[model samples]
Target: STWDSQGEFYESEGISKESVKLALKGSKMREELFDHYYAEGGEEAVSDDEMVKYLDDNYLRYKSISFAKTKASTDSSSSATDSSTDSADAANEEAKAKRDEFLEKAQGVSFDDFDSIIDEYNDYVASKKASDSSSAADSNSSASDSSTTSDDTSSVAESDTSSTASDDTSSVSDSTADSSTAASDTDSSADSSSSAPDPYANEKMMNYGTMDDSQKDTANGKILKEVSGMSTDVATAYEDDNAYYILIKGDVKDRDTEYAKDNHEDLLKEMKSDEFQKKLTSWVEKLDIKVNNKAIKRYTPKVVYDKQTEYYSKNNNS
Candidate 1:
């Protein structure tokens, strides 16, 4: 109501109340959807369309998939088997081979089996995290017992500097930071958040359209875009800085018509811009035209202004 009484002020400010209303309306919509989702059984009862729309609106839901790398003993599996440089090269190749094998396995996974796979994947991740954490604590205990650097699984320290190659809702990373002889890292009471094993480190849960425009131009983003276009039935392969990925896109809903209508003012401005000047001039020249200069001069300025407002109000809605 205040806006109605202060039309000139709004015109001068150039702020669209419709856009503000839409932004604020998001919270209410989320609350309603939460109620709606639970009213139906959380998973089985939710329709395909409902899931698609929820994801399209950027909710943190995803199809959880496993990504445990298979260990096949290679000829130079250990550094002692060869020279230092050669051994390191062999280890890298072995890791790549294992990662590629998992990617291949992931590509064959059907969308229907995704729901069934979640429990197994979750259990594996939870166990791996527990084991890594136990190993770290034991290493720290031994180091403290006998004043020495804890050279146990550097996985505890590695997680600290892991690359953020995952867009999973759980936010695990895939980097392997080198363990240093620094005594500070040997503390059994190191920050739990830093030492905790990343949830998606050994699993691959695929998310969609999570990257910004800048990321889309990168090799990572380009590959993700390619996966987004594929059907959910078939998985697609990609990789980032520290990890390989096998992702399949989720179902998506069409763009909202109501949302598009929010940009009608922009559309109107573009149509009236200088780029259309020649076409507009041609339309005016070809169309029937009339002048009422002498008759118009009889009406007051306020009456002419009211008429102009009425004309725009009718045309704008159309």
Candidate 2:
């Protein structure tokens, strides 16, 4: 038995003296330990230097992080075992149950039904793109007009403020220059408008009505671009009670890709539009599905613990 600083006594499993030797030799066991630690910590997992120090300083803690959860499930659960693992299992099961229920409800749905939904979503995207483009064009036109107005006002002010004949002549010259500048600005705006790419190119929705049998087969089960205003990649469809989902696999435009990268969270939030979710909620409610929370909580990961701890004394030294 070993007594911790908390005055709690627990059964002691003696340290494995071969741990440091295995780690130094780059053994497969040590690699497995690193994998567990990485999985637990994700992108913020300890660096190589910090990992060595961590292994040396808290060898038992490292072992617990690696294998304690597995051991607890096989053996009886102890107060020392993390309770959060139970909650994680419950959450995962709840999500899975919801997805299963959704799948069940979606069964018997036809390809035409999926097509209609996708078409509606694509039309919405097209309308939004058109509105945005119009607004931008209007803004540019307004800015150009405002600049021209400013130049006209300045010319009138120079003529009003003039006292000498030379100043009056200068005012006339300024007015002529302003007219030329305004003309140049108009030409530039026209040139830019002509060069501008078609905003509707990426915004065009797929027409299911025009698709042939081969095209339909090719288009099915592909990833759709997020710019389509559809939140899900797959459209649920089934034939004769067999569920076969079709994925929207459309090419993503460069503009949409850049926008998604710049505003990832915002784009996601937009994708989960209130109207789309309300429809989803209505469909789920119609199914009258219910989940078993108790059953979900009962499903936890099987745990196994390793009794090897080679560096017990190494903890205090660090």
Candidate 3:
């Protein structure tokens, strides 16, 4: 009886026996049902027996069609959401990769290097401040002393002239007083000149030496060669004063030279090793290198022009 009622309802709703059968024949019944309903108009007449049979055969099929459509719409919405999430994830991954690259570039720099630079800078600033303060005090003291000397000179001149004028009325007194006044003026002038401080005496000369530029270059080269273990000629040519090179020569010289002979190769290997660089970086971080009394937390040395050229040439070749 329920089947019969459903069949009547189907007939009223315009679903036919053939349409019901077609819809039942495939999983894509919702699409087929819409096509069939539209094709047959809003209502299609059907026999009560045929309608009852159709309803009995495809009742679940109609329900399945409805469910399928809802599922498809939900699936489309989910796919769109998933696509957005995937794009976001890809963007995040790209950003993370860039950050990792930056960190890698920043690696090997130690806190000691920063500290060393900072300390050096701070010391330089302190020295400058002290020098400036001393200069100021010296200038102020000189000014005060100059004023007092001028006043004393004026008083002496006034007293000497007054005594001479008074002595003019009495011949012996005038002559004696005039002579004494002249002697006093002469002595005072001499003393003042002798005691006067030379302003230029405190000023330092800028020139370090009279040695020619070529001689200076040669001297610098020798120093660099001794410190860097490079050829004297090459040192002269390149003028490398890197601390790494200096440390290497100082520390590794005994191991590599004929003087040491033993484990020369091993020592050389160690000097040029990454381990040495790491150790140096660690040491620098610990020492906290300061330049001009300023603390340096981070610094990157400029790549040598030769190295940059080599890198570009290699990349181009590749």
| Top candidate (TM-score) | 1
Candidate number with the higher TM-score (1 or 3): 1
lDDT of 1 by residue, 1-318 (tens): 545754444443343667446655875764454434333453324343544443355312123332322222355647544554564445445545644554565565665444334444345456655676777777766656775465643332422111111224222231221111011112223335796743323222223244457655655445445655667656555444444445544443332232223323232222223334564577779989998887667556776666567656755752
Clashing pairs in 1: none
Cα error, residue 151 of model 3, in Å, equals 11
**Which candidate tops lDDT?**
1
Model 1 off-target regions past 4 Å? 1-108, 148-215, 218-220, 253-318
How high is each candidate's TM-score? 0.35, 0.17, 0.14
Q: By TM-score, highest first, what's the ranking?
A: 1, 2, 3
Q: Which of candidates 1 and 2 reaches a greater lDDT?
A: 1
Worst 10 residues of 2 by lDDT: 60-69
Question: What are the per-residue Cα lDDT tens digits for candidate 3 across 158-193?
Answer: 111110112111011111221111111111222344
lDDT of 2 by residue, 1-318 (tens): 112331111122322335334544665654454344343353434343443332223111000000001112332466434564564445444434433444454345442233343344335435545665677667666666677555553211111111111211101112122111111111122234476743322121222232244433442211111213332333332211111222222233322333333333332223233434575577778996889887555543321122113233434442
Backbone clash numbers for all candidates listed: 0, 13, 31
Where in model 3 is the C-alpha error above 4 Å? 1-112, 148-318
Local distance difference test values of all predictions, in order: 0.43, 0.32, 0.31
Mark the 10 consecutive residues where model 1 has the least summed lDDT. Answer: 176-185
